[model samples]
Target chain A: MRDRVELLRDMVLVRQFEERCARLYQEAKIRGFVHLYVGEEAVAAAVMGVLQPRDRAVATYRDHGHALLKGVSPEAVMAEMYGRVDGCSGGRGGSMHLFDVAHGLYGGHGIVGGGLPIAVGLALADKLQARDRVTVCFFGEGAVAEGEFHECLNLAALWSLPVVFCCENNLYAMGTALERSEADTDLSVRAATYGLAAWSVDGMDVDAVTHTAQRAVEMARGGAPCFVECRTYRFRAHSMYDPELYRDRAEVERWRERDPIDLHRTRLEASGDLEPGAFDAMRAGVDAAIDRAVAFAESSGLEPLDQLTRHVYAAGPEAGR
Target chain B: MSRVTCRDAMGRAIRRALLEDDRVFLMGEDVGRYGGCFGVSKGLYDEFGPERIRDTPLSESAFVGAGIGAAIAGMRPIVEIMTCNFSLLALDQILNNAATLRHMSGGQIGVPLVIRMTTGGGRQLAAQHSHSLEGWYAHIPGLTVLTPATVEDFAGMLGPALADPDPVLIFEHGGLYNVDAELPDEDPAVDINKAAVRRAGQDISLLTYGGSLPKCMAAADELAASGIEAEVIDLRVLRPLDDEAIVTTVSRTHRAVVVDEGWRSGGIGAEISARIMEQAFWELDAPVARVATAEVPLPYPKHLEDAALPSVPAIVGAAKELLGRG
Candidate 1:
């Protein structure tokens, strides 16, 4: 793994990028459903750090961070949100469906718990083909309430599939709290019943996520489907339209005290991996990249109306690449 | 020509696919050791082994979605839902993931998934196990729905459907599985896009597919006996309707009786009738008639179930009523 300095930069890149997305959403520059990954940067950054470029990752709708971690360029990512023809998904997917197969980001699935079965299938293929790669499926604790979650977990275990189920327990599934949504909030315990080697990690700490993910990836490669429930929280509302009525403001503030980016930055500084004032300079570079992404997204063209019916069904052998 | 059951023909088709493509595998409930719920995959598990002829748990959504996932990830997975009724559990995955992924990804991904399900009711399996919903699937744009009635279609359609880059749904009507038919001299390869004219006549067109094909043919025979000379057209493909065939047949006959085992309202019959109105209204001599299952949850009792479904007499009666000879 690269030094913590690089990890902090990726986290800051996500933080700075989505912070701009929040502002851009307000300006009417980017419309439609926008779910931000404000506080959960460490999970994507650390988990992706453990994966090779050849490996696949399936993520949920709040997936800008995951897309970036999987190496989708900031320009393509922002253009997708802009609904432009040049976006990673040609602006067809928008924020909820950011798919860049070249980057091995299988999808930006919009449905809750919808991507689990697909994830199991991806891993199943790799195993059947004897390909030495792991597929990481990222979903929230809320998805655990879905039957697909249980079904997929059981199926994956039965097959000994090469998949790592990373549950980012953001404590909420939209407006419902984890407690209200599930019988037992301990997602790891529930996963254990399915014969998977499951555990939870402190998602606020990038190192903890990295350590847990490295082991999980190893376990997956060894033909054991594992589950890692990262105890994290989204510092923002579920989406831009959310009224934020379900949770207490004090609770948000309390969780904010251990901000993932801030915690990682402090750790890097204490370990002498960073010089004083390094975060500011690093963030400036990331912000400049985000600015370029915004400019590119703004200049890109919208898909023509006549082409609206395109790709509904493939006409050729090389249909969907 | 050799005689073969629809079930064996379908099994041969699946077996051929597995032999031809290493990427092709069949996965579904009771498909492995159980030899498929309908026995359409009998002896496949032993021939292809467990890896290729995978048997999955009863979780419809997961297995179906997994098929989509595997298809997109470079495996040609043929997933079988025990029945169309059970497929409702996996509708979210099918509608949201399998059907929408290619377009949603801007054509960057296509789910080359082939989903097979048994449809229609005859054996008193009751409401849950026996109701034809292929019409409902036909409404989805990104999907290709096929209702293979003849043994030839049952054997032929799978190869072409497996070749399709997008998702394809094949609804094997439950009652037709054991029908015995003579195999042609050559391979049974046929088109998946056009309708097949089963019997040619000039009085009226009897349009149908899947299990309803035989019923329509029987009705056409009855009409022929009564000097009606009705033309029977098997609509093999459902989603991309054979509009040309539908219109041309109606133009030739100037009247049509659409037979569907599904419920009448908002069914495939409705869609076909609307298309006929749009394309062949001028040629039509009388209003198009639809013979569909009674709009009720199929009953368990044999008598009630028989009453609920479209029968030969009902189809014949509809044909006569349209021709003003009832």
Candidate 2:
């Protein structure tokens, strides 16, 4: 197990990194649908912490945190959001569609439940090829309503595919709350009916998520799927365009009380897992890294207009055109 | 040396693909013990067993997306959707993930996946299983759509499709599955890029593919008896269509007719007719004639089904009209 201090750093980096992204969006540096991962850092951080470099990770649109945790250079991710040629996706996938195959991060799938089947496939390939890598797919509670969620769960279990479905039940699918969307609000319980190891954990606690994810990853590596419901919250509105009309201010304030980064910091500081002055030094390091990322994004060039048709097919002059 | 059904040729192609590459697998609903819905994969399950030849649940979105994923993760997967009609259930995955993954990922990924589905109408399977929709797939930039019309194309296209890194869709007309042809002494040379001149003449050029191929051939035979040599061009590849073959044949014959089993409005026939207008307009002695399926959903009755589809009479009528002999 990684020490609480490192987990603490991962969560802090996500919190501050996305805070910068929000400011960038406001300043018009980043355009398109920007979904901030304000309160859901622990889910991505801890899950990514448990995954080996060989294991794959697939995430949804609010995916900056996952990209960061999966080892995509903060520079490349920020550049991608900036829609520059230097972006990880060569500026083809804006904020909603980041991809870094080398780090085992499949993509930032824009569709609600699109990544689930792809995750099943990645695990299917691994299982067939006799590799023990586990594929961890992250989606929101909104996706539970999609038929793909049910189909993928059944297929993965039926095939004993090595995949871990981590549902970040942030209680909303865009603006629809979990209760409004799901017939039964307990997402993991519905998942368990598919005959896999299913459970929900406090997504607000970094240590708890880390512990749960460790077991889930191992369970998947043993040659069947596992399901984890990280009951977290997105402190911000769904997107930059959202007006914040659906949820109560009081409810948002209440979930803010259990902020994942702050809660983890307090626990580590009291447990002496974090040394004196370590908190300040860690935040400083995160700021410097993010500063470099921002600088790279600002300095990067946009892809040329003529190159637009490139990569549509794998090559051959007749393909993409 | 012998004659073989197009379906058997297709099965042999898939079986050979599985044997040549360890990374190849055939997956779809009823593809294993059920022996494939169309019987194209009849003996493959017995030969390759359950590991390489796997049966999937009836969820098209999941299994198709799984095939796309497996392709991206470095495997050549041959996914068989029962028919083009059911392919609609998996269209989101096909268009979104399989087709879009390559360009959207900015050259970081390529889906070396081949999806095969039976298409066209002659059987009374009615509305659900009879419509031809490969035209819709050909409209996408990231996909390669091939409508194989001959036993050679059926036996030949899969190998190259699996070897290519892009997503390719092979639409085998359901009506032509049982059509028989002499097995070539050696495997007839074929590719996924060009059209073939099935029969040559000078009076008019007959453009067609898939189930429409035989109808056009019969139309040519009928025209030949009347002393009109009608050129027959098999438009095997639909996506990046062989425009040169179309222009060359039309440029020579000075009259053209497009035959398609898909619907008339916005169908591939329309696209081909438009291409003729664009590239070989001055060469045309008259407006290009189009022979496409009627716009109505196909009915279950055999007579109505045949009536709704392009037939030899329709092709012959269109060809004669193009030559001012209507």
RMSD to the true structure for each prediction, in A, is: 1.8, 1.2
lDDT of 2 by residue, A1-321 (tens): 456788899988999999999999999999999999999999999999988898999999999999999999999999999999888888889888889999998889999999999999998999888987999999998899988999999999999999999999998888888888767888888999999989899999988899999999999999868999999999998999999889999999999999998899998889888888999999999999999999998999988777767888777446633
Chain B TM-score, candidates in order: 0.98, 0.98
Interface RMSD, prediction 2: 1.0
- Considering chain A alone, report the TM-score of candidate 2 relative to the true chain A: 0.98
lDDT of 2 at A208: 89
Using lDDT, give the best candidate's number.
1
What residue pairs are clashing in model 2?
none
Q: lDDT by residue for model 1 over B1-326, one digit each (tens)? A: 88988898899899989999999999999999999998999999999999999999889999998998889889999999999999999999999999999888989998999999999998999989999999999888789999999999888999999998889999999899889899974558789988999999999999999998989888888888899998999999897898989999999999999999999999999999999999989999999999899989999999999999999999999999988999
Q: Calculate DockQ per candidate and list them.
A: 0.60, 0.79
Give the best candidate by DockQ: 2
Q: How much is A293 displaced in model 2, in angstroms?
A: 0.7
